[model samples]
Target: MQAQTNKTENNTNRATQINARDQRVVQTVGEAFVDDPRIVCRDVNVFYGEKHAIRDVSIDIARNQVIAMIGPSGCGKSTFLRCLNRMNDTIDGCKVTGTILLDGMDIHDKQLDVVPLRAQVGMVFQKPNPFPKSIYDNVAYGPKIHGLAPTRSDLERIVETS
Candidate 1:
């Protein structure tokens, strides 16, 4: 009877341990995205050569929310925005470290292609920087590149409306 009692206690202890571990895993993931966030960054550091442009910045943007980051000029608002779409990749000496996650996926991972990433996250510049070409050319550029138009007439219609 004592042996049976010991076996039952062991099973109960094992079940308790498994439950604790499962709770911990769920808690850890929940902490990563607070308030139902869509984007989360932790310990995010960015540098330009030896100069640290952004340091240890952590922020979470919840779904269907608007966040405006306002500060003095050169406080890295545009720099951080550029980091989102990997626009800084084009710069000569810019470097970024740490991690940025979109839907809990690492965006800064080297394997991730920035092309489709930028396409998914659209960007409207500060001003309407029209293409050096005509209004028709400016509107047709994206449609043509993305193969949205089959013929020149289709491109012309898009240009007229856009």
Candidate 2:
């Protein structure tokens, strides 16, 4: 209980630091644009009612490249990543503005279906998210639903390879 209380206090301090940092109009480090970007975010902002969570953020993430989100405890790393897949939509009073594109398609488009978009672009958490049953089912679930494999043998092979 003491440790939990300490953690909460620490996070509160970090949140205050993050808020102060966001007030500075410093230029973002590194090049913000790229030619072959799989994901593009432009002037992205997030608000929880009146509180600005993320401010004027932009970046280009190229395909087949790995990137890390590193920051202080309350510095909006998860908030920005959530914008990539519209996970923020589930949160009440959370609103995201500006643009996010995946493979040149608008992620925030009202006409875009979220289910298949999520299937195409998904996040891997530190903990594995599995079905109730088996390892094979967990590995094969995506391919099975998307019809990536035409036959049972192919599915088995895909599972084995995974």
Candidate 3:
């Protein structure tokens, strides 16, 4: 249809306009908000010292909904994803400012412990990091430390089920 073609052209125009972007986004297009959201992020911003890596981005991730974050390289996809569980906190001089809530709990709260939070929500990196020599150790490590399994037998079962 002509309308679909026009939309693609418009999107291409927008992409071409954003050459080496520096200014913060005033707003996002499309339906960025949703009803019955499980994760709510409002005005989320990330700064690596002086560089504003992620500008004022906002969105609502609805419960049981599949969402995809598609963008070119260095557009802050990974940086913004790290903001979800406060992974940016580990990086020295990397700061995040805004409201991000996971099921109404403020992840940015200083009093919140990151260990369990990480277990609850974490990133599966593109490549496995420092995996133990054995594939079994790599699979069982998380369950072992998290006390998911009470005994070696249970750990084996868990790994097998996985």
Candidate 4:
């Protein structure tokens, strides 16, 4: 009985040690990046076959901050913007590597779907074209399509908010 008790105690101690180690690893990783992040791009690169579009780039965007990328044409500002939503997926021979994280989750992971990811992150085009339809129709379209509003009155409220 004493030998069995010792064996059980040894197993319990091992589990406790493992749990402690895991907690330390989690804490260390969290602390390493959490001090500053609204966006973090690490060693990001984009290539179109032999053509390199974006070189290794690392940047951080803090909360409530605006980040702008400006450069001559073909310098990868749009390439990098498309990278945010994996829009590069459509281009032939386009390849992207390294890591881009939003709120600390890998955006490029195969498990992450781009559609909803885009809806949440949101995007407004650089152009200033207004909707051709009436303001009411223009504003109502999104909520109606997405079923965000169940009734006409609800859609009216959404259009007003827009």
Candidate 5:
């Protein structure tokens, strides 16, 4: 009985230490905001049914700057990213709150159409499956569909630049 109690105390102490360390890391990392932000997220929260997936998260993404979301699996990184473009709307019970702004415009506004929003903010999935098209066609798909390039040569230029 004494050995069992000692083991339990050791496990509790280890868990407390780990939780403290994690809190420090979360506090220190990715808390700075930029002067000119391309995207801003304020007081964001996400819920799927009864599960609170994300809570009170805020961040800024600046133009021409790359940010990485680093966390363990099932830690709401993907959920938070999907919220940027209102992708969570597809799920039946998923709910998002707070403000997500793209160039100072609220992305979750009723007037905003998700189709154009998705075209503007692209997401690359983890799975690798080639589109059934020539490399040039695949590359030009977005610009062509969005009317960004009116002519073939324009599309070629866009693809080349990209």
Candidate 6:
């Protein structure tokens, strides 16, 4: 009985800690917009099947300014970031709603192709998974696949400059 009581107390303490942490996170992100933002996200929500992941999130990312999303585990920081570039589209039963604008253009517009949009807004994953290719091939793949470089010499120049 004593052991059970101790466990219950510990769980209560953890819950309290999590609540306080969430409050702090909300306060920190209260002012989510910036002047002259390069990217704008409004009323964004994400749902995975029946699980609601992100809720009514709105923010602005300013040009040349870096912003970090800080929150407790499972607080939807990654989900929110993935929504910016529509990376969540690949997931099964993952639904995202809201407007994400890049340079005043809607990224999710029907006329806008995803391939070019992905290239324009680059995403760096937390895990490093280098492609199984030569260093030059890895560096040149994006430009070659996207047809950004029209010739072999152009590819070489791009790789060198990068």
Best model per TM-score: 5
TM-scores of the candidates are 0.56, 0.61, 0.61, 0.54, 0.62, 0.61
Off by over 4 Å in 1: 1-33, 123-162
lDDT of 3 by residue, 1-162 (tens): 000101122222221112234522232344556667888887677888898776555677778766666566567767777888776775778999989898899988889987777766656655445332377877886787678999889998999998
How does candidate 3 fare on TM-score?
Answer: 0.61
In the predicted model 6, the residue pairs found to clash are none
State candidate 4's TM-score. Answer: 0.54
Tens-digit lDDT track of model 2 for 53-128: 7876667787887777666566677777778988677567899998889998999999998778876776765545
Candidate 1: worst 10 consecutive residues by lDDT? 1-10
- Cα RMSDs of all predictions? 16.6, 10.2, 9.2, 18.0, 11.6, 10.8
Local distance difference test values of all predictions, in order: 0.59, 0.68, 0.65, 0.58, 0.65, 0.65
The TM-score of predicted model 1 comes to 0.56
| Total clashes for model 3 | 0
**lDDT per residue as tens, model 6, 1-162:** 000000112222111111323332212313456679899877677898897666555667789866665555556666777778776775668999888899999988989887877767765656554454578877987787688899889999999999
Predicted model with the maximum lDDT: 2
Encode model 5's per-residue lDDT on 20-124: one tens digit a residue. Answer: 223322123333356789998766778888876676555678888766765565666677778887767766789998888999999988999878888677666
- Stretches > 4 Å off in candidate 2: 1-29, 125-162
lDDT score of model 5?
0.65
lDDT of 4 by residue, 49-105 (tens): 887666554555566755565445545567777777776775678899878887888
Quote the lDDT for 79 in model 4: 72
Model 4 whole-model lDDT (C-alpha atoms)? 0.58
